[model samples]
Target: MAKYKGRILFVLAGALLIIIWDFIYYFVLQYSFNLQVDLLFGTLILFIGYYTGKNYDESNETVSAISKSEEKIKRLNEELHLVLQNITEVVFHTNSKGEFQFLNHSWEELTGYSIKESIHKNALHFISLHERHEFLRVLRRSISEQKEKTKIDFSFQTRSGQFRWGEVNIKLNYDENGELAGTVGTISDITERIHNEEELLEMNETLAIESQKLSVAGQLAAGIAHEVRNPLTSINGFLQLLRDDADEKTREYLEIVFSEIKRIELVLSELLILAKPQSVTYKRINIVETLDHVAKLLNTNAILYNIEIQTAFKQRDLYIRGDENQLKQVFINLVKNAIEAMPHGGNIMIEAGLNEYNKVELSFKDEGIGMKKQILDKLGEPFFTTKTKGTGLGLTICLRILRDHSADISVQSEQGEGTTFSIKFEAAHQQERKKREQTQKVW
Candidate 1:
C-alpha cells in the first residue's frame, strides 16, 4: 500500500476523527464533548474545506482560458466572411473530388448565378468545352506535384451562356495534419484585356500597311512622271515636225502621234483612279455585263500572251450593288494577273453564279505557275509582289474596293498546282446587304 501525501492524510484524518467523535458522543460519552476535543475537530474541518476550494479555483481558470480562445476564433471567421463578400474577383475552394466547397460573393456577381445554385456543383461546369482539357491538365499536375501555386488562362461560361476569358491562380490546399484537403483558386475576368490586345495588334498591322503604301506611292510618283513625259515629248516633237514640213511622211507621223496620245491618256486615267479618293456611287450592277466588258477590254492583252479567256455563267442576271467602273477595274486587274502568271500560255477560266450561301460567287482560276506560301501570305501588302516587273498594287487596290462594297475575297494556291481567286458579293434581291450592315455596325 502506498503512503498518503500531506493533504490526503489531513483529509482522511479529519474524516476519521469526526466519525469517532460522533460515536463517542452518542454511545460512549453520553451527549457531551469536551472543549479541547471540539477545537481540534474544528481546525481539521477548516483545512479540508480549504483544499476543496483550491481544486475548484484551478478548474475555473482552465475554463476561462478556453472561452477566450473560442471568442477569438469566432471573430476571425466573421472577418474572413466579410472580406470574401466584398472582394471584386472570384474566390473559390473545392474538395479533393473537384466539387465546389465555397464560392465567394464575387463569383455570384460575375457569373450572375447565386451561391445557392452553384454550391456543390462540379468546378468544371463553368469551364468552356474547348478549355476543359487544358484546365484539367493543369489542375491535375498541380495537385499531383503538390505545387504551391500555378496560373492558367481559360474561357469561363456565365450563367446567361456567354463565354468570357479568365485567368486563374490556383493553390493546392492541405489540412493541419498535412493530408490533401482540396484546392483554392482566384479568377479574374480577362475578356476586355484580351480584346484590347488584339485591337492593338490589328492597329499595328494597319500602320505597317499604310507605311508600305506611302513608300510605294513615292516610287510610283517618279515612275509616273518619267513614263508620262516620254509619251508627251514624242507627241510634241512629231506635231512640231509636221508644222514645219508637210509631206508623204506626215500621215504616218500623225498616226504615231495619235497612238502616243492614247497611251498617255490610259496611263493618266489609271493613276488618277488609284491616287485620287473618289466617293462611292452605288448602282445595281449586272454581273454578266461587267464580265463581258472586262473580257473585251483585256482580249488584246490576252491574245498577245497566247492565253485564252474562258467565261461561264450559271446565272446570267446575277446582280449586286457597286460602282460599275470600279467593278470593271477589279476584273481587269485579276485577268491581267492571270495572263501574267502563265508565261507559257494557258486558259483563264472566269465563272459567276449564286453560291450555296445565296451570295454571288465570282472566281478567276489560272493554269499558271502557282505562288508559294510566303508570297501568297503577303498578297495584299503594298509593294510586295512576286513578278519581275510587277507594281504590286493591283491586288491591294482590289482588296480595298472589295471591302468598300461589303464583299469578301479568298485566294487558294498551291505551288506548281495553280491558283484561284474567289470573290463573294451579297445578292441584290436578298436582304443580305442590310444584314451585313447591321452586323458590321456600319453607320
Candidate 2:
C-alpha cells in the first residue's frame, strides 16, 4: 500500500507540473495546449491518490492489530516458562520415537542432566535398564489401546549413578486434526517416600512380632513356671549334695549335672524376663559410664579369646532415660557376643556417638565371622542362635530390654566380613529440646 500511495502522489505532482508548464507556454510563447486534456489528467491523478491513501490507512491498522497479537503471545510464553521452571515435578515432551524434545527445570535438578544435553536423547535413557523394557511395554499398550493417558512407576537413573523411583503420568499429544504428535509427561521423584513406606512396613512386621511375644508370654508363663521350677530346684539341691562327697570321676559327673542344672536355670530366667511384663525403671544415666562399665566387665572374656576390645566414645556426657540394669545387660550381651564371635582373636569395637536424628547410637562391631541375610533376619527370635553353646535367649533379652526403653536396634553383617550391631536410643534431653522448640513456635 505504501508503494502504491507513493506512485500515485508522484503521478499527481507530475501532472500538476505539466499543466503549469502548458499554461506558461500558451501564455508566454503563444504555444497552444489542450485544456480539456489537462483537466482529465488532473482528475484521474486525484481519484487514484484518494483510493491509495485509504488503502494505506487500512494497512497500518492491520499491522497494529498483528503487533498486539504477537505481544500477547510473547507474554503467554513467558508466563508458561515461569510456571514450568518453578514447578517441582519434572515436565517433558517426547516424540513418538521416545526422543526428548523438551524438559523442564526440575528435570535438570533431579537427573543432573541439563536441558541441552537432554534434548534429542532417548527418554528411556533416564530409566533403569531392567525397567526400560517394562516402560516400553506400557507405552505400546497405551498406544495400541489408543489410550489418551497412562501412568507407570519405574526407577530412573541419575547422572551420579544413583537410581530413584519416579512416578510418571503421560498423555498422548495430538494436533488439531486429532492425529498423534508425541507424548507429554510429568515425573515425580518418589524415592524418599518409597523408602519411608518400606520402612513403615518393616516396622509393622517388627511390631507384630512384639505383639506375639506379649500374647505368648501370658499363656506360656503360667504353665511353664509352675511345672519346671519345682523339679529343677530339687535336681539342683540333689546335685549339690552328691558333689560334696564324690571322688574325682563322680565329682566330674556331679559337676556336669550341676552345670546342666545351671543352664536350665539360665533359660528359665530369660523366659521369665520375656514372660512377665515388668515396669521399666527409667533413670537419666550417663551412657558413657554405662558402656565403659560393661566393656570393663567383659574385658576378661575378650582377653581370654585373644581379642582386643576397643572403645570409641565420640561424644561425652551422653545420657538416655532407660532402666540402668537392663541397659547395662544389653551392652554386656552385645559385647560378650562380639567377643565370642572371634574365636581366633579379632578386634571388638564399641563405639558411641550422637546421630543427626538427636539419638544416641552405640555400635558393637566384631571382626569375627559374620552372618548371612537369613540369620540376620531371624536374629531376635526365641531359640534362634548360630553358636553351638549359644542360648539364643541373650539377643532376645537384649531386644526386649531395648524395646522397653523405646530404643531401636539394627544389625548389619556380611559373611566373613564382620558384623555390626547398632542400638539407637533417644537422648535423655531430646524431649525437653522438642518441648522448647514447640514453646518457641507458640510464642
Q: Which ten residues in a row have the lowest lDDT in candidate 2?
A: 1-10
Q: Highest lDDT: which candidate?
A: 2
- Residues 1-443, candidate 2: write the lDDT tens digits: 55466556656776676667667778878866777976787677666766766676677678878999999999999999999989999999998788999989999999998999999999887789899889989888787777899999999878998889999999997667666679998999999999999999999998897769756764575567779999889878887887888899999888787888888777777777777777777888999999888888888878888988889998879998878888888888888787777878989999999999978999999998899899998887777898886767778878878877889899999888799999898898995687699999999
lDDT of 1: 0.81
Residue 189 CA error for candidate 2 (Å)?
A: 11
Superposed on all Cα atoms, the candidates' RMSDs to the truth, in angstroms, are 18.7, 9.8
lDDT of 1 at 83: 94
Q: Which pairs of residues clash in candidate 1, taking residues 3 or more apart in a chain or in different chains? A: none
List model 1 lDDT by residue over 322-392, tens digit each: 99888887899899888888989989899999999999999999999999889887887755778765656
Count the clashes in each prediction.
0, 0
* Residue 355's lDDT in candidate 2: 90
